[model samples]
Structure formats: C-alpha cells, structure tokens
Target: MNFDLNTEQKMLKDSARNFFSREADKEFIREMENDEKGYSQKMWKKMARLGWMGLLVPEKYNGEEMGFLDMTVLLEEMGYACLPGPFFSTAVLSVITLLESANEKQKKRLLPKIADGSQIITLGWIEESGTYSGKGISAKAELKDDNYIISGTKLFVPDANTADKIIVAARTDNSPEDPDEGISLFVVDLKGDLKGDLKGDTNNKSINIEALKTIRSDKLCEVTFKNTIVPKDNMLGEPGKGWETLNKVLLKAAVAKCAEMSGGAKRVLEMVVEYAKMRHQFGRPIGSFQAIQTGAAC
Candidate 1:
C-alpha cells in the first residue's frame, strides 16, 4: 500500500499552508495570545469563506461534505502555523459530535449555522476530577417541566468564553452499578445579553467563565453552570446512552490532535535545521557537524 495524499488532499494542505503563512504569522499569533477572545474574527470570517468551517458538515447543511482524512490534512497545517482559535473546538469536536448523535431536526437547525461560521460550539466534559472517564462526569442534569436544569462545573473547556453554544455532558441518572450509564449530552445555548469581553447573561443567571492561562496560551476556560436551563429538544443522542457518542468524539479528537502535533513537530524540525545551517561554531556551520547531522537525520 502506498502512503500518499490524494490530489484533493494535497491541494488542501498547500492552500492551508499558504493561508496561514500569509494571514497568521508569528506576530499575529502573538497578538491573539494577548487578545480577549484569543482569536481574530477577521481571520475566522476568511476561513468561513474558504469553506473550512464546513469541512465535515454534509452538503445538504451547506457544508463541503469532506471526510476525516481531509480534515487531518488541514489540521496539520494549522498546527504547523500554531494557529490560535476555536476551529478545533467548533469544527472538529462539536461537528463530529453533532453528526454522530444529533437528530435530523437538531442537525438541520444548528449544522447550517455552524457551517456558515455563525455558530461556535465547544465540548464541556472534563470536570474537577480532570479525568476523561465516566466517573469524571459528575455534573447533574435534572429534567423539569419542559427543560433540563444542568448544574455542574467544567474545567479546561476550550473556547467556552467565545462559544455560542456548549455540548455539556451531564449525569441524568445516578446508577451506582454502572458509572457510564445515564449520562446525557445537552447542547446548551450560551448566547445571551452580551456584557463585556464575550461574557453573556442567560435567563437563569449567567454562566460564569474564568479564563485559565495555559502554557500554550490557548483559550481554555473553567466554566461554571449554576442551574443552566436547556430545552428538552436540545439533547443529543438517546438519553442515558450518550457515552457511546462521547466516546466516538474523544477518539476522533485524539486522532486530530495527533495530526496537529505532527505538523508542529515538522515545523520545529525545519526551524532547528535552519538554525543549524545559519549559526556557525569553531569556524564551521553547526549543520556541517556530524553530530548535528546525525541528530537531524533522526
């Protein structure tokens, strides 16, 4: 078997590389690190115009109807450029979850907005336990008359501060026999009366989001939900059986993240080789040294 990118994949990789090189240079990336939203709306719009936001969405939903491998090519380029934004959260994580679990009506209602870049969604999974297992999900979602009241906190949620909606994993039933059972996924509407710095006030008290400074300076937040109200129709997948869908989301996310890291590694290697060629020591370029060459070869 041959391991080669198809013609379309090659074109996608090249276009993404060029776009990042021209638009999201080192300086721009640094600026976004300090920005409140941690990304550029201008660049987001441009990517939307490029149909990147809809890469995995179905054509009927105004998407490109691309496959996972195609998405991997694009993500690799993004990682090489160290692109900072909600693209991973919105495009990959949320999109896959919706596709794998959402009902037809839910997809029709939300997928179009996501494809057009008008909507940004993130997953609210990791909690205080900081584990990615069923036991890690301690948040509770109680069903009301026509709504589900979600009360819990999510840690390390990417781009929650800027997302229009969040797919929250909550425990709808407490089954001591099996921790994974009775877990449900709810698409919580976060859009509300805008206050400041992307903060909004929902009907039942505003969802508190505190930005956490990470080593990569990526936009990660600790989101606190104090009686968040979600419509019953907003639930994704079958009730008490959301773990299967969430598991699929996590698997895809892992593969996408590996692709991103590969790109970053490639860029680092290039930078190191360039530096070795430029910096000379003992009247000879470092790259000319056998030791340097051997290390680079690996």
Candidate 2:
C-alpha cells in the first residue's frame, strides 16, 4: 500500500545523486570513455570505501548485506549518471551467482575479494547466436583429467578487458534430447587480462578477447576460448543445473536493469523540460506552448 521511499532509502538516493553529480559528471565520463580500461581505479576504490561494491554480499564476507531493492535504488542512480565499468557484472552477476550456487569454500575465498573490490568478475553467457536465454549457451566444457576443458566463444561480454575472473556458461553434458540439459557454469580466472589464458587452467592454449565498439562506447568484447581448462572445483552449481541458478540471477538482473532504465528515462525527461524552458521560439519560451507542455506531460 505504501509507495513512498522510507527516510533511509530517500537519504541513500540523495547521497548517490550527490556523489554522481560531483564525481561522475559529463566531463569525467567522457575522459573515462577515452581511457584504456573504461573505468577509473580511483573511483572504483572510492565506491568500495563507500560500501557500494559490497552492497549485495553477506555480512559474513564483510559486505553490507543490503537487499535487492536497496541495490536497485543504487543501480538507478548509476544509470542516471551513466556510470561506467563492471559495477553490474561484479556486483550483480558475480555476487548473485556465487550466492545462489557456490559452496562454502568458494564463498569464503572469493566473495570477500569481490565485496572488497580486490577482484572484478564478469558473466559470459551469450555467444554468436546473440541470445540471452539458455539456448544460446553452446560453449562446450568437456570433462578431462579431473577437470573440464572449455572450448567456444562468447560475444558481447561486458568489461572482459578489466575483469580478474569470468563465470562462463558452457555445455558439460551432451544430451541431444534437451538443449538446456547439458549447460553448466564455471568461474574462469582471467589473471587480469582479456586473454583468459590462465597458466594453470590452459594447456598451452590461448584465449582471445576482441573489443567491440557500441554507440555508447561501453566496454563490450567478444571472448574466444580454445581448449581452456578449469579445475573441477570451479563449477558454480550442481552439474547440468546451471541454468536453474542463472535463471534466478537473470530475474534479479532484469529488475535491476528495469529500475536503472527508469532512472535514465526520468533524467531524459528532466533534460527535455529544462531545454523547453530555456529555449525561446517566436518570442516565447517553448515550454509555454501547449504542444511542448503536452510533450512534457507525457
């Protein structure tokens, strides 16, 4: 019945807005867009210090233990400012997936690093098919020597150039009956490069990362895996059940994305209204015209 944000939520929103206005202005954004990593380490550290990087991680891992709605509010502000980097991938994808499926050891070792911003991770699901659902997950993870050998490519991977780890989707089982049956998830160590050719994981095979330019200039990359090896312990969830875990993460991700878009859309409306008020046509402010008022109303 209550639609209003509580006092704490309102304060949180205002704090985020103030931070973005002061630290992520257009000039800073443009500068970062031109930078190699497409993100500022200083800013990332500041976010970690502000307890944002750990918004979703549990208190046991030194996280703030915030709920989904709280993180969604922050995401909205991030979108309004068009915040760059792997905030979504690290905070949402890696954190949520680990929480959903990882065992206690995995949680203890990795979740702390993520919560403190010591490591940046990404999720690679889409391939050349360009699908977000389960069907597009055709990357193979053949079992070999107490480990899995991954061979395939992922397209439109976010911020691969900067991530320390990547939780990749691969097909572990070869059942032709159900397309989604064979799918599984693995956390691949990138060692801080787009070329995920890990020394321990790879059998002298090279992984690849190719940058793709988007209209917004976000860091998108096409990642190729050629006989990449991963330890059996890297498995995120039960074998042949990764989609089940990812499905839940996908739903949360959807909500977070929708909230962010809503904020961005609101920002657009404010910009339009300001332009209408400042720009005069035919000796009157455009905002004074009924047509402009109608546009603003909508």
Candidate 3:
C-alpha cells in the first residue's frame, strides 16, 4: 500500500499549515502561554467558522463530518504552532466518547452545540493516582431515585476551568470481580443548564475547579465534585459498562496526540536546521561542518 498523502489530505495539510502560520504566530503563542484562558475566543470562533471544531462530527449535527485521519492532519499543524485551547478535549475526547456511546437523543442535543463552538466539553478521568487504569478511578457515583450523586476529584483535567460540561468517569459499583466492570460515564453540567427532561439542581456550586500551574500553562485543572447530582439520562452508554467506551476514547486520543507530537518534532527539526545554517563558527557556517552535518543527519 502507498504511504503518501492523497490529494485532499495534502490540500488539508497545506491549508492548516498556512492558517496556523498566519494566525498563531510566535508572538501569539507566547501571549497565550501567559493568558488566563490559554486561548483566544476570537481565534476559536474563527476556527469554528472554518469548520475545524466539527471536523469529526457528522453532518447531521452541523459538522463537516471529517474522519480521524483528516483530524490528525489538522492537529499536526496545531501542534506545530503550539496552539492552545480545549480543542483536543472537546473535539477528540468528548466527541469520540459521545459518538461511540451516546444515544440519538443525547447526540442531537449536544453535538450541534459542540460543532458550532457554542459548547465546550471535557473528559474528567484521571485522579490523584495519575493512572489511566480502571483501578485508578476512585470517584463514586451513587444512584438515588432518578439521579446519580457523584463525588470525586479529577486531577489534570484539561480546560475544565472554561468547560460548559464535563463527561466524568465515576465508579457506580463499589466492589466487582473486575476493576473495569463497574465504572460509568456521567455528563456533569457546570453551567446549571440541564437539557431535556434531565433538569435538576446541577450547577457550578456543586463543583470546585482550580487551575493547575503547568510548565506550558495548558489550562489544566483540579476539579473536585461535592455531591454533584447528574441526571440518570445524562449517563453515556449502559450503566456499569462505561470503561469500554472510555478505553476506546483513550486509545484514539493517544493516536491523535502522537500525530500532534510528530508535527511539533518536525517544526523543532526545521528550527534546528535553520539555526545551524545561520550561526557561524570558525568563520564558517556551523551547518557546513562535518560534525554538525553528521549530528543533524543522525
């Protein structure tokens, strides 16, 4: 099989490269690193207009209906520019989970908003243990009448500070033969706007979000839930069987991240080559030196 990018993929790569290079320059990236939200609302809306936000969602939900490979092509450019925001969390993590698990009603209600950039969602899975295994999930969700009262702290949640909703992985069963058997996924509304017949007292008061100090200033947060009530209808997939879906989401996210890192590495290599060519040593360009050439080649 051929490994070269197809014509459409090549065009997408070129467009994304040009867009990032022109919009997310070095100065803009530096500014965002110190900004409170770690991204610009203006630029985000621009991306939505360009249909980047809905690259993976189906056209029925007002999305471009692009596939995963197409998304990676765009993500690589984003990584090269060091673009910061909730794009990965919302587009790659939350959207994939919803597509793989959410029923028709839930998708109709949520996916459109996500596609239009009006809603921002994130996944809250990692705990203080910092492990991705099922045993690492300690947050508990207890079913009470028509609701599930969830209590747990999620560490290093990306963009939780600005998220409208968070899809949390909580343990619904205290004890099971297998650690991954009893976990459930719940959609926690941070803005108090519960949709459909699932309306309840869900609000920001039940949640506490503290932005962590990351070296890259990536808007990561420590989100704590204090008796947060999520409607039963908000749970994605069957109860006590969310680990499978979560695991799938993680795998896809990992691949997407690798693609982004590849782009970043490519940019770094280009910078190194340019520097070597320009910097002079012993009255000659260092890049022309045999040692420098060998090192760069290796």
User: For each predicted model, how many residue pairs clash, with residues at least 3 apart or on different chains?
Assistant: 0, 0, 0
Deviation (Å) of 91 in candidate 3: 0.6
What is candidate 3's CA lDDT for residue 2? 80
Cα RMSD, each candidate: 3.0, 2.5, 1.5
Q: Which stretches of candidate 1 lie above 4 Å from their native place?
A: 193-201
lDDT (tens digit, per residue) of candidate 2 on 117-212:
888989999898897777878899999988898999999999998888889999988665777677899988876342423333533245788789
Reference-based TM-score of each model: 0.95, 0.94, 0.96
- Tens-digit per-residue lDDT, 182-284, candidate 3: 9999888887765553363446698999999988889999999999988889999998888999889989999999999998988988998999999998999
Q: What digit string (tens of lDDT, one per residue) describes model 1 on residues 1-298?
A: 8689999999999999999999999999999988889889888988998999999999999999999999999999999999999999999999999999999988987788789988899999999999888889989999999888889999999999899888999999977578888899988877764343122335635478889999988989999998887778889999988888889899999999999999999999999999999999999999999999999999
Q: Which ten residues in a row have the lowest lDDT in candidate 2?
A: 196-205
State the displacement of the C-alpha of residue 111, model 3, in Å, after optimal TM-score superposition: 0.8
Q: Is candidate 2 or candidate 3 better by TM-score?
A: 3
Write the number of the candidate with greater TM-score, choosing between 1 and 2: 1
Model 1 steric clash pairs: none
Deviation of model 1 at 160, angstroms: 0.5
